[model samples]
Target: MTTTRTVNRAARIVLPGVVAGVLAASALAGSPAHAADEEVPGLHLVTLTGPGTSATPPVTGAPDAQAVLLARQDAVLETIGGPATAYRWTTALNGFAVELTADQVTALESNDDVAAIEANTVRPMAGHVDLSAVRFSRSSDPRASRGAGGSGVVIGFVDSGIAPDSPLFSEVRGLGETRAGFSGTCSPGEGWPASTCNRKVVGAGWWVEGFGPDRIRSSESLSALDVVGHGTQVASVAAGNSDVSVLMNGRTMTSFSGVAPQAKVAPYKACWAAPDPADDGCSTADLVSAIDQATADGVDVLNVAVAGPTTTDTVERALLGAAEADIVVVGAAGNGRSAFAAHASPWVTTVGAARGNTLRGRVSVVGGPAFTGASRSRRQLGPVALVLGADVAADGAPTEDARRCLPGSLDARQVAGRAVACLRGGIGRVDKSEAVALADGVAMVLVNDRPGALVDDFHTVPTVQLSVADGTRLTRWMKRHDRTTVRLAGVGIEKDASEAARWSAPGDDRASLLKPDVVALGEGVLGAVPDAWALFSGTSAASARASGVAALLRAKHGHWSASVVRSVLTTTARPLAGTSTLVQGAGRVRASLPRPGLALDIAPTRYRDALEDVSWEDLNVSSIIMRGGGTTTRRVTNLGTRAEYFSVSARGFVRHRVRTTPVALRLGPGESASVRITVTGGGNPSRFDDGWIVWRGARGSHTRIPVAISR
Candidate 1:
């Protein structure tokens, strides 16, 4: 677990002119970017590495010259020529100074000798979805609830592109549909292209010369618009409108709602076949251009439902690339009744769907294989806590809404200390503030938000996110039955199952690391969905709800980084009270947590040196092969001058097995990139054995070092 992180100048090698500038700056104090006035020289921060090969040259011929010492970065090499093998003279020319333009820097990196490059800085998510505990926090509309989709946050739904103006959904008419094409399978013919969209109009595709695998489109792509309703459903969950109404029972009833109702949603549309009885989504190439387009636009959170199988290498790169540009990439954990860890990468947050997203929850507790007869009863003995904020109004006034909905658990004269409900719904201190206000006299308050979604909370006393259905019933039953002693005890279901939700995709990405981050109302959680209102579902909603909490946390820890948000959310998540490890990763996400230490300056042990000369060192393994059989020994060199660590992880390989201990790695001074991989040399060399060697750390970057393990 040793990784080399690139440190800022002083640790990095300083190039010539930079050295002169530094000398000049030293000559007149310590300012470089602007020191030319008082006899001081203007210095720039930079790093240089090699495997270099240019027809021309650099400010310094051999990248390892003294001029490289002034950049003030570190000692690890950032760029390289190709994957290094034993005895390949891998040198990390770091901490150099240069006067090169952004383009010049690119050209210098073009050399055949640069292996990997490290950066001095990193991007931190502050006003956006913390990809880590990403709960869809809700926002009060000046009307309903405030969760993750805060009023100002911009979450872009960039799929086959959003048909915002489509006639199919121009005015909201149920769901839309698409026509299926033919030409399925992995291949077509000798001269035919492996295009997911075939020229034919058959169920699978047009007539192929011979026969091959078939072709299909996304459920939303059935016709063109979201005829099938996947896209719109996802959108609604992210930012839907919520409205409350009274049910026939004369009892107050609520419906499912989106995480954020007013947060502007931009749809980057693309066209792909959905998964059905006959096919899965299209190839990876189909979405690459779309992702690139989104990145360029600098979108914040990106929801991807039609993710490729863990087997798709190109697709993985696309995911990594999106992260490099600061895009929060999210997707559904496959529906495969299986599990893996690939999706749990620090850069990506994988979500699962709750079978029922209805705000009017219809919770089902599966009895032993046979026991079908169980009596249903109202919960009693608990303080009736009302949910406040945006889960109640516009701008997330859950507390206000809670108060207005039911002045008191009992009549005002009898309602001395009733429990108030709260969630991390986005309106800053709304959830906690609401709870505290409600728990005025009573001893405790029921947390009405999902602990499994986001960690937004104000610990005024006691609370947790009970199922909306459970909470409502518990609160109402208490006011009706418990006149004297409030029963925190109710006959209801707590998260009591080992089954993964349907929207949760199954996993097989041991390389990427996958797991059910958590679960929440995704199917039809009632609330708001834009224009008017509708029930929304999906982990997206959960995250939106979580976002609501995050907003509160943001207020609590104004200086905290995205990692901090994730750390608190995951660490505080209630461990699943079940048997299997699949249903909930660390447990359901919790809304309240005792502050970690006192200072919000979170330095998660895993992030000791998040941005530095990232490299994989001391890698050793064995293998047995024949003719084309052999092991590729890749030696990563920290050409940078600093002594730190960087991120080291790889993915998307067929028979070529890959593994990295500790997930994160640290590298010392003068380190080298080394990996003793035992790969079989018995595949179609161009495809199977050829996989991408990714190096991602500081620079908000990712490098796909294509390696021919069998060359």
Candidate 2:
């Protein structure tokens, strides 16, 4: 759990980019720009292509393939007689989702058994974790304190549901059974019953017919529980139930766990919570029906956490049919430091969001000045009386809404028993510490008028936050001290106050590959939510700890495939340091892996021919971009055993030249090798270059990969 590494210099991507056939465009078909076919109303979807398609249930010879895709969606609704259907989708896609009408979406775009239709939109919700800050890998078996590694994998969690009485989700002792091609179950709805799925939450569903039961809001939950706490804090950061503890306002504070704390959690739910509880969404036909019910419930790592599609939609062809059925999805690279990152479908594994070292709180001030910040408030106040939330407004409020403590705009006799300070934006930061604990304030400092990531959250009182130069030096020492004082203190851990995260989201030169295929830790992490345990921060909690490190590498390589577990977590990441490669791409996310003795895998029919070809810069990916200075080729294989060799070395092209035809390699065990590389100079075409190639294995074992280049 140490990790420092440092390098920083990877941000350029503003070119004449994104034209190479835009993922072979053409998925969301017509209807909206009308003025004549006039019938346009709502809810759509469609999707069906070739071979009796439906998606999940027994689909090979199409065993009644969702009743032959519902008799080809009731023969396109009895030849445009329209009106009935509202959902069908076989497994993760084969599709239907009804209620259209711009002349039945221009007659299902001249139906050839429709391959795309459109009109479903809604998406939102994306937002946890720390398992030894990603050094991850534990499990020396003494039952390793009850399986510390992800035993039989599982991990589905589409989003927004699951609290099944959180004790971080107990019952995981030895975690043995449950794996025979899992078929997923647990349905019980409304407060989530079905005995709340035991064995660490085995399964649980939810959908909402593409989020529309009149926009939910009858206090949420039509079942799979999680009354808006981001799917029980992203299924407790992917597979909860381990050391647990972590409380907060009721004390406790630390013992966490998850990142495969013995994996197995299914969830599903597909996001909801709207009537403005700060809005929430999800519906691309309920995320392609919860990715075709977690790919017909055989789940083995999915965790989308919303906002995907950079092209070929229908939720990126249901995450390319959940990575051609071997699963391992993991998405969310969206939060916005000027947007760009958001699951650009390279068969997912996107991630992004970093800023390690956390747990803060401190604050100080007595004769003025101390700092620290973020915090899960472990209480302790002292020399209190600090004031300034615009000096406690309330009566006639709006002094900038009592300096941003908006809720009721302060002034409980100048914030009772003192502390206040406020000012951060207008709303949430735990609602300005619940408007300074509803004006009976006893703490809260907040501050930040820009300059990002401080967030430890879970507050109700004793908080801290700050930054923006320590909130302008405590608002200029409380406008040049008259009384002031302060304190708060207590909490702990600190270090990385910042390194990437102005809302982590930058990877867009329109894809030739090199998206947020990595980066983790994600701001203040912590996890579990319903029955308490908080502190979140986004990239959907680094896509649920990269789907708990792809369920602890599919519970120890049970024949690794979803593109060799995304090329062994993008060539064994660990690159960060002042970020680039369009903001932390192949970096930070080390679950102690390092043994990709060479891999690259790809095939989902070459990602459906790079989504129907213009050649996605030759896709055998392990992160290499080259955009302007090109020449590609890859291959690899030989995942370890006898006759090894390697040698290669490239290390950060800086201005590019990189040639690589054979710098040395031997292979033999399961043999395979190719290489080629190229990348000429790097002069302009919109700058931005990156590095790392490495290989080096004569038994000191190494792999690395990464590489980038702009023009």
Candidate 3:
């Protein structure tokens, strides 16, 4: 019903200045490079580029490279004023995460081999799915038919800790074997026992300081248990037990299951619990430690549901090492309506939020059009008197207050026997309905102030929400006629539902890469939480659903690399009906058996600069000036056994003319060919022009590559 403009609050990232005077004083004194522990408190991630260091190493387990880099790091520390001992995490990129003083930071930055110095920023934790739709659980699906259900696959979660006692983490629900590839261990402390590491959860560890004996325990104890509940919820969504039922407000909803119910979990608690259980609090050092451990443990997938700035060099380097090891790393695009740092890196499979299948009450006017809205109430209200909120409110208050149906603004005597029509804005939708009920109104009708926006709300009384167009019509009719009426209808369960949530992070990333590789059910997703099950929302929930799909794919195609899994998910996704690629990426993920046909093993590279010289790994297009053109190349391989023919075409607006050098191609089995696409803009670039380059195979298989042009 009423349209409301959603405002996204961007999280700010600020790095403090290093004190130059302290460094100068230390250097002038020729101070013995050992400083007292009480120097500087903040942590910093420092990266070095030297003889043996590489950003993308060929091998994941390059102990030699790590050793060489660590030696260099030790030498640098010996030269700088070092503390007696420092808490540090080293990655393959020759990067070290450590707390340092201003003098130490200045010395490190000035080192001959040091490449970059950045602050250790915190990333906020940001999943569910119907397994059948993604082919993971369908009876005929190969993986499902073989009873794989992600058996033998290890999916790692780097987030808040998990609840080891939950039935979802029982060995009976998992592979019931400690994966031989894993070499990690659980730290026994607080309420967590040594038994926490089992066949189901093969590894459990937490990296938070001040967890020693003398500290007062907060909501999240100094243990590997999930006091915050987010980690447990996400873990269950990705790989919970089979035949699970979630308790929603005292009632049990049955037949619930995770995408990969049999996949073993490796819980790495990098995030600490905050005062608010929903919010995430962890440092870059903690995340780097978790990544390094997960990579060393040799897990198949790393599902990081955290969102934040990607400038943390140590975390990115560690993730690159994980990717080199062929781990499927999934991350959440930020909840903010802008580019998110954590998901901005190309190595991570970023996920955005989408609506899931859930039952909601539908509302319609007695004599007007049916409006798009949702309510939690199951009871229907018959025809009742329709009264505008402003017409029945107390005097002396601003008109806006009555329009918003603010508490105490409505007149109790005038609205006692009618359904008050209130405009949407200023107050919470549920709170507005409660205000109407407080004024003795039998029911409430909420109209959207903006056009085309329909919001779902929970009400304390019989209520119906309407879009701006319908609300305008209802309000006009009520003013012209003395006795206008409306009806609220209760719709039973409906299935296969989907919508691009307004809160889902937008993909206006700085690098111009199409963000949110794909979307999945994130809103009101029912999953495991602590001892019971609860509903969770946000991009974090969406990432869990995608992670489960990845595990299933890994179980079926153990030989396929992480890139191939990402390619299949993105290319085969179902595009949302009315949304652009920027909002929904390749669309909602659909699970189906991989077909043998033309498949692009890799998407086009996204570049950072307009020249497109530097390789932007996961980006599709670098940059496009208005009325200017650009060309990018992509390689397509024939996965089919026989030779196949494919025709290429573009979908979306006509402002940009896209052409392929070879409009059609014929490729033999396992043959690969590169296709060059030239895009020419016809008009000035006002905003991003979104489209897709689709390959249609003669055998009915198809794949798509999302492309965009922006100023």
By TM-score, who's the top model here? Answer: 3
**How high is each candidate's TM-score?**
0.38, 0.34, 0.73
TM-score preference between candidates 2 and 3, better one: 3
Residues 1-711, candidate 3, lDDT per residue (tens digit)?
Answer: 110111111112224322110000011111111111111246666655532222235476666766666777787678765443334444324556566777777776567666566665444556221111110111111112112378878898988889877767766633645446667777787889887777778888887641122222366667678866778889988887676444322343245567887888888887765554323355566777787778777888898876654332445556766765667788876554534323555567777777665445554556765654555556778677778888887867676798889888998888887788899767666568878888988888888786532333335576666667767877777777877777777675444434776666666523435667888777666666665555566677888888898888888777676767777777777777767666677788764445645555533121112112223532332111122457777787776678889898888755788888788999898798878888886587655576778888889878777776655
For 103-181, candidate 1 gives per-residue lDDT tens digits of: 4445445543332322211010001111111122332222323333233334445332233332111222111111111
Model 2, 1-711: lDDT tens digits are 110111011211111111111000000110001111111238777776632232233636646666766776777677788577777776556667787767777876776666667677666665522211112112221222243777877888888778776666666576656667888899997777788887778888988877777877878878878777777777777777677655434555456677778777888888888787434567677778877878887888888776543555667677777787878788877665545666666778788777676668888888878887878667677888888888779898878888888888888887888888877774556667766777888888887777665656657677888788988977888798788787887678776634565556677754667788887876666676664555566677777877787788878887877788878887777787656767788787786656667777877666655555434566787887666676787888777778888888787667778887888889887688888888887667677778877677777766677776754
Provide the clash count, candidate 2.
13
Give candidate 2's whole-model lDDT: 0.69
Q: For this target, which candidate reaches the highest lDDT against the unseen true structure?
A: 2
> What's the TM for model 3?
0.73
lDDT of 3 at 470: 69
Which ten contiguous residues of candidate 2 have the minimum total lDDT? Answer: 23-32
